[model samples]
Target: MNIAKNMEAIFVAAIVIASATSFATAAVRAPEVITVKAEATEMPTVTITAKRLTAEEKAAL
Candidate 1:
């Protein structure tokens, strides 16, 4: 029974240590920055011409 209790304590200590180590390493590590360069291009221009239909043209249709 004492040995079993000692093993349980060891297991819990191991888990706590592992969690603390992970947190410490994460806090100590620095983040990486990635940069991308893209070329800018001009878009093509579009022109549209529209005429309103007269009353006579509507009647013809």
Candidate 2:
């Protein structure tokens, strides 16, 4: 019974140590950053349209 308890304690300790090491390494590591570049092109043309309102249309408003 004592031997069984000792083995169980060692197993639990091993698991705790493994978990702590994994967490420590993760905390010490830095995140990677990636950058992207894009080239600009000439601006596209824009068109505007206008129409004269009829006297009757203006009167309706």
Candidate 3:
């Protein structure tokens, strides 16, 4: 009975140690960095023109 209890304690201790170690390792390591480059391009220009309405057109509306 004593040996069984000691073995159980050891098993629990091992699991605790493994969990702590994994957490520490994960916290201590830095994450990977990635960089992306986009190509530059010129856009086309647009022109707009407006015309004034005559008195008859305004009356139709």
Candidate 4:
């Protein structure tokens, strides 16, 4: 009876210690943010022109 109570107290103490240890080891780290900028430059663009062949050109083919 008394021994069982002591064993229960020890078990609870062990669980509490284990939990505290884990929490200490798993401490949260501060987050860091980094920013970068580039000198803006004009982006290149391409232009394409297309024309359909006439009926005469198609007949020659």
Candidate 5:
């Protein structure tokens, strides 16, 4: 039982080491950045008039 346990532990350790080594040896590439020019836009304006009403006119049904 003890021997089997030691072998299992060794197998797990070897797999972990192999995975880490392969990841370390992989090629790394840098990302690219792009520059763009934006066009300016004009905003539109709005004008409004306020009408006044009496309380008696507002409460009438």
Candidate 6:
């Protein structure tokens, strides 16, 4: 009788452990990756020159 009771206790403990592990394995989350995105606050722009640099200064650069 004592052996039967001990076996029943172990069986219940194993079933509880297995159920907890199955729940834990099934509740897995996907790996998260960090993504960096810049918000475009404004569009591209262009500017025209009214006065140009000297030829020697441009060539020296």
lDDT (tens digit, per residue) of candidate 2 on 32-53: 8999876658677888798988
lDDT of 3 by residue, 1-61 (tens): 6877699899999999999999889868587899987675966789778898999999999
Residue 25 error, candidate 3, Å: 0.4
Clashing pairs in 3: none
lDDT of 4 by residue, 1-61 (tens): 6877699899999999999998997877868989888766986789778888899999999
Sum up the clashes in candidate 6. 0
Candidate 2 displacement at residue 55 in angstroms:
99
Q: Write the per-residue lDDT of candidate 1 for residues 1-61, one digit (tens) a residue.
A: 6877699899999999999999889868577999997676976789879898999999999
Model 6, residue pairs in steric clash: none
Q: Point out the worst 10-residue segment of candidate 3 by lDDT.
A: 36-45
Give the range where candidate 5 is weakest over 10 consecutive residues by summed lDDT. Answer: 37-46
Best by lDDT: 6
Which 10-residue window of candidate 2 scores lowest in summed lDDT? 36-45
| Model 6 poorest ten-residue lDDT run | 1-10
Q: For each candidate, what is the lDDT?
A: 0.88, 0.87, 0.87, 0.88, 0.82, 0.90
The C-alpha TM-scores of every prediction are 0.39, 0.39, 0.40, 0.38, 0.38, 0.39
Residue 41 accuracy (lDDT) in model 3: 91
The parts of candidate 1 lying over 4 Å away from their true place are 30-61
Clashes of 2: 0
Instruction: Give Cα distance to truth, residue 56, candidate 6, Å.
Output: 94
